[model samples]
Target: MEHPSDRPAGSHEARDLTRTLMRTEFRERRSVTTELAATTVRRPPRSTREIENSLRRRLGLGRLGERLDPTPWLWGWLGPLVVTALAAVMRLVDLNHPTRLIFDETYYVKQAFSLLTLGYEGDWPAEDDDENDAINSRFADGDYSDLVSEADYVVHPQVGKWMIAVGLRLFGADNGAGWRFSAAIVGALSVLLLARTARRLFGSAALGTVAGLLLAIDGVHLTESRTSLLDVFLMFWVLVGFWCVLRDRDASRARLAHRTAPIRAAEESRAFHAAADAAARPAEPDRPAEPDRPAEPERRGRGVGVRWWLVGAGVALGLACGVKWSGIYAVAVFGVLAFAWDLSARRAIGERRWFTTSVVRGGIPAFVALVPTAALTYVASWASWFAHPGAYRRQWAADLRAAGEPVPRPWLPDWLNSWWDYHLAMWDFHNGLRSEHSYEAHPITWILQLRPTSFYWPENEPPPEACGAARCAEAITNLGNPVIWWLAVPALGVLLHTAIKGRDWRAWAILAGYAAMYLPWFAYAHRTVFSFYSVAFVPYVVLCLTFVVGWATGLLRPPPHTDGWLAAGPAASSRRGGWRTDEPTRLARFLTDDGSVRPTPTAWAILLAVVALAVVAAAFWWPLWSAQPVSYDFWRAHMWLPSWI
Candidate 1:
């Protein structure tokens, strides 16, 4: 008997596991790529040609053809640690600000308190406006249980509330720290997640660190990181789902390597045995042992391991949906992307049944992972509601059952029925939510952050009385840092070019994330919206910007003759190259080939300039972004544009 250690990597059990993953990967890749391709429209300048050029020239496309050589230190564990530390500092600093309900926190916080007290969100009396306000204000003194009875019609999902409840449980419901815990933790983790993703995609620590820092500083992200809202939670889970899908891709590839070896070995052995038997046939013509024949219905590309990651991805995406219905978009996008990766793997191995096996092996297993896992997670998210019959919409199942409509007995369960009813009610409320308000915003302005939501407004105390200035205003506004956001517009252009021209999968990944979080809001322009919702996409935008900056810096090269020329160029540009006898733009020629900037002298200048600009910008916006008190005139002066006012 063979020892377990001595057993071939392609043994039956191993192959079985690989086959399972292979099947899952095949369909997942197709689904994700097709959806991604559909959502993407190739515009001019950043079209297919641009992608080709970026790959060939900018990022060294040819090198990939030789070997799978990843930069060693750049992609290892160190990048994540650095990124995580920076993210934690940015998110954790002065986290317990405002010390009161802000914006939609008035709704979500109360809902969580109600859930905690009575296991449901009880209706607030419209008549006792002052009483309700008093109760809300005196958060610690209120009888929270008195707020519940029948369920309140909430527009958002239970998952976000549950997350908020966890924080409330830990830090006490009255604390601002409790309310903002969900966003802060999720946002910090997002920085770490994006950092790891960038390192893996770009193979550079500098790039990864830049990505993390940019995300850490983005205004929208910063605000979300300091708030208790469902959007931030939505962002967190969608990112988690994305990461899990990537893991599934890698795991599937590893499985392929393990499963293919035995088939190759067996085929080679059979061929050698047949040739020998043929050579010795003359010695015994009457009766001889039959030559070895290859196994019938040959296996497809070596199987990867079982696709546990896909299942995990499904569960994560499901929880995302439980947080917000919009998460469905992410699920759809990632599902298709996972399958596309599988198809490419099979095609690379020259499998005859590449498409068939990809579909057969990858499709069903992917569904098994995604469909049921999502369904279950979504149901499970409503556990609190299910546990308490008095919770809003919890009795719908009982009401339906009492009506006795002879439904299929096997197809129905109380948990599923209650969850379904709750969703139907939630959907109805979301669709007809057309109420207008003083600050109600349209989604069209979300991209440019035209209409940011103001979260806090306290009674005026004089400058000295509060912090500073006359009538101090402690406000929490959802806005992104201009330096990061303004730069991202151009960065997005670069990333789009890189994705299409260079066929850089990393660029495509960023583009996909940005498109998913931002574009979906555009479809809902008629609905009341706010810039705060854009926080979900801020990390992607910052990441894209940082990546482009890193790319620009990474391509710098030394000039042919003058050392200053190399210093003049970006740090990462090619060190040697010619203009082919003709000059281009003065900026282009000086920067790219001539190498205008050298590390010795130019680095200090650039670093100083950048730091100075950052400091000045930060100072200018300090009063607004950080809730610093200033005169109304001073505040007006800071508002550069009419929209900002």
Candidate 2:
């Protein structure tokens, strides 16, 4: 190469030889750098914040803007209160009409009056006996003094009668207002509860108001509220239990979030320091110190403890059972629901053994919190019966002991034995009831509201002052809003689809509530169940319908890719040559378009139309729902189906 360079400076061979040497040196240096990088230990970026953000998103707490704020107390109570006031007016107005015992009121009202006076349900004469009318007349005239002292073998629990006793104490148990007063108040309060529950469940106050409004005006709910019936009380307690469970879900998630925050922050700080040191000392062998981080918290084991809200739910469900045995179904359903929710929560937080941990650790605490509390509350509801030694079955253990017969559960106390015997007898009575009545409907038809029970229907009278027709009718039929009830049939189907496909927790919870309240009736199809029993689950039906309406109207969430339409202003509309977008928006804008401001047209129209239709339907059926007098032709006109007749 030196000889070639001396011969010619610009020779190709000489230049090539020089380039080869330079390339060899570059290759050696590159190989050394690659080997050093391969031997070095690189620390990954910290993921604590990322993991926490993911968990928050999974728990639906990430979007704080979508949630009602701390002052929700003011807005929350305002809408529900208005709806409850409407319910109160509907239930309390002309409450004492017909001035007679209707349907099962013959049993419950009389028993309530007896409980108020005798601290127990007293016996009543058989229907065939002439004294039945005399006892009823005395009860009607505010005279409860001559009631028989022997304990009545009632089939239901004593708590509902206790509630009725409250009304009797306040209003003097003679009038319908006195007997139905507490039911009315509870029914109205149910509206408040349902509204608030919906608000929390759907994260929208308007939807909650809609749900409450529907419940307030539904004829079946109104009829049950205005009657001295146990179903309304049962419904109230079940709803309270459901609401409490929802509260627990939120509170538990919040607790988990609170517990994990500091751990995440510490991990992030260590990651930042490690990263900074590595960057500053690139020439030296960069060694990241093993951070003195705290042990990773168990995601499922000790994050969220057994919640107090669950205990509240248990107490509420127990009260439901105290009202009626049917309420136990809610306990069973919601117990499973709470556990399932725990599983979902753990899984969402990236727990490895979510199912096993949820069952083994979470299940135990939840059971201890909910089941035992419910059992204790149920037992406590029997306090009045426990106190009244002369009540029915209260002497069963004493009689058995005196007769030298072995008492059932001899290890238990006398009161416990007596209570168990009473429960056995009650269960037997419920299972064996084969009584027939004209209004008795199959459970299958109850959902459709095909054969509504006529709570009150005075005999038609023909007179000059009678309703302006040849024959007059005044009746209170426990019918539902045709639009709402009929619509719920399909809405429930939609809920089932979403629950399975989307695994939406809300849909599953609501479906569980409906199944608990409804599906059990199939087992007792042979028994005389009435359509009025559907009242207990009507709030859920309305909720289902409201959910569907919200989705359809884009109030709950916008349809996929339709957010563009929401963002599109009048200018965009003009640019698109006035091409309309969403149907709801188009219809709403067509009906009430004001050029100056943007409006949630679709949501407003759907809500207003549904509410208006409900109001009109209620008005059309008001005479029948409230037992108000109407002409024969007018009453017949309201019979939309032959089954309704």
Candidate 3:
């Protein structure tokens, strides 16, 4: 400023000139400087850092610069562990108290024990005979000698039973703890998975922990965890698949950034060189020459490829299917989600013909990655049934051939034919299950926890020492916490609006998962369904609710400074200063905020209140969830609605 060249080397003016010169040099020789900057840049642009950080976050690796500081990641895992421990205690405590099969446990528990003893499920004697009760008692007493060998015509797939079989094999299938052990363990682990998944989705460890806490205390999840039910396992695998797909999304974006960065650098370098060459030469009036054209940058091959996380999703989806056929809906939905993500990523990178390129290049690879892996994994889940000739319908093809009946698909192997016929029969059973029951609920009612299924209710039970009344009731009801489930209704509405209007990828992902698990049931409205089935999508419900809570608590927004501006300092102030003061902040604001200041106390207070209410509701309903002895009057007080009765 005071004859800048005359300023001292360390003066502010000299430093400014140095910075400008360095920036110009780097910009001009972009290709040559790109490798140097990538290797040595002390601080990269926010967008670049975000792309790289997203990949690391998905892999459960914290920031690259924070490799030496384990506190952030250490606390991340520790929080989930603490929440999972609480979940485990809630699910595993007094697991053997009931000492009897409850509701659908009458079907799955026995089938699991049979799967452990025989290679497949075995039929129990008719319910009208006393032998059935005797078999139940003997099985409970760890005696299996009287069991029949005939194969059972089970309606569901075998993965869930196999999961139950693991516990039975470990604990001798004599106690409720033995049959329900796997469900309890998987249920607790689901809390862990959901916490970590929410952390990545929302970029907040506190929000993730809150989500885990809610799922841990929700009565429906608690009861399903305590009981041997397929829905819990289905929930676990579906959540796992959802988590995998999210990771794949992060990894794909990071990969695309890395692959395209070089092309950008090359183009910038050619442009700078061409401009310099033109400026250095003087034009001659007599002989005017054409200006030099910048050489085109070499094209890089298609950068995106099949992701391993997608493969993991396919496997998880397959396992989900192995637990229940309803999982196919998720597989179909997520397959489309994967393709859409690829298309959006390509379009974002300014690629021409992105739609065609994504479909031709990314879509085919995704299909190959997901479908084959899922199909193979699903087929592998039936290994026990396929290996055991005593399984039901194992001889259908041979019998048809013996009877001179036309063999459907005669070219197929006998085992495959039999497997196909078995699947058809199972499909028929599912579609034909219109029999009515007291606890049966429509899919519409499931979101509101209406008509919760009664898993256990003891008859002629005397009052225990804890009960003040003469008559007492012991029951397990698959109800949900009213505060959390009811709140999810409005939260979901907000999520839909945000997803559509703002084009929020996170909202869309959460909505896709919710729709996959819930909307498919609408098509089967005639079939008998229960409120407990909603457990399969409970994580999404919690996610939606947590997202709203995050916004309300200002966790999703930058804290305003005392001067009524964002605390993001000069950079964010300059960019956002143009926005009117009353205008709503966008979710993308997180990308620019410094994230230095902690969220205000009000945000923490709101989160604490939500958690506290959820815990209180869980405790008030624990007697019903755990089938504990309570006075008839006390039980009646806990039923908040007539439908709950």
- Candidate number of the best TM-score: 3
Ten contiguous residues minimizing lDDT sum, candidate 1: 558-567
For model 2, residues 258-293, the per-residue Cα lDDT tens digits are 566556556556655654554444342333233335
- The CA lDDT of each predicted structure is 0.64, 0.76, 0.78
For model 1, how does the per-residue alpha-carbon lDDT over 1-645 read when each residue is reduced to its tens digit? Answer: 654435588688866766676667766665554454334323112333333333222212222134322333423445567757766776666766666676678788778877777777776544575676666677744345446366777877788888888888888887788877777888889988877666555544545555666676666777777877888888888888878887786667556534554554455455455545444444232333344464453556545546899889888889999888888887777777767667655655446787788777776677678878887898788777778887776766667678985433326687667667667777777776778866677776666677677665556534656654554455556666777676677778887776665555556667778777778877777776677878777767866775565455542231111112111223234223222344334333322222233333443344345434544665566456656566666766766667765
TM-score of 1: 0.74
Model 1 C-alpha RMSD vs. true structure (Å) is: 17.7
Evaluate residue 539 in candidate 3 and report its C-alpha lDDT on the 0 to 100 scale: 90
Instruction: Write one digit per residue (lDDT tens) for candidate 3, span 1-645.
Output: 365546787788788887677666655564444444344433333454554454334323345465322443555677778999999999899888789776788789999888888989988866664666667777788787766799999999999999998998887688988989999999999999998898777665667788888999998899999999999999999999999988887677667656665566556555555565555555453334464566755543355666899899999999999999989888988989888877766665556677787888788888888888988999999999999999999989988999999999999899999999999999999998999899999999988987888988866675566677777888888899888999899989887766765456677888988888999999999898778999999999999998778766655432221121111111221221222234223322231122322444675577678888888888899999998889988999988889999
In the order shown, the candidates' Cα RMSDs to the true structure are 17.7, 7.9, 11.1
Better by lDDT, candidate 3 or 2: 3
The number of clashing residue pairs in model 3 is 0
Poorly placed runs, candidate 2 (over 4 Å): 1-54, 62-75, 127-130, 264-300, 459-464, 558-604
Error in Å for residue 382 of model 1: 1.0
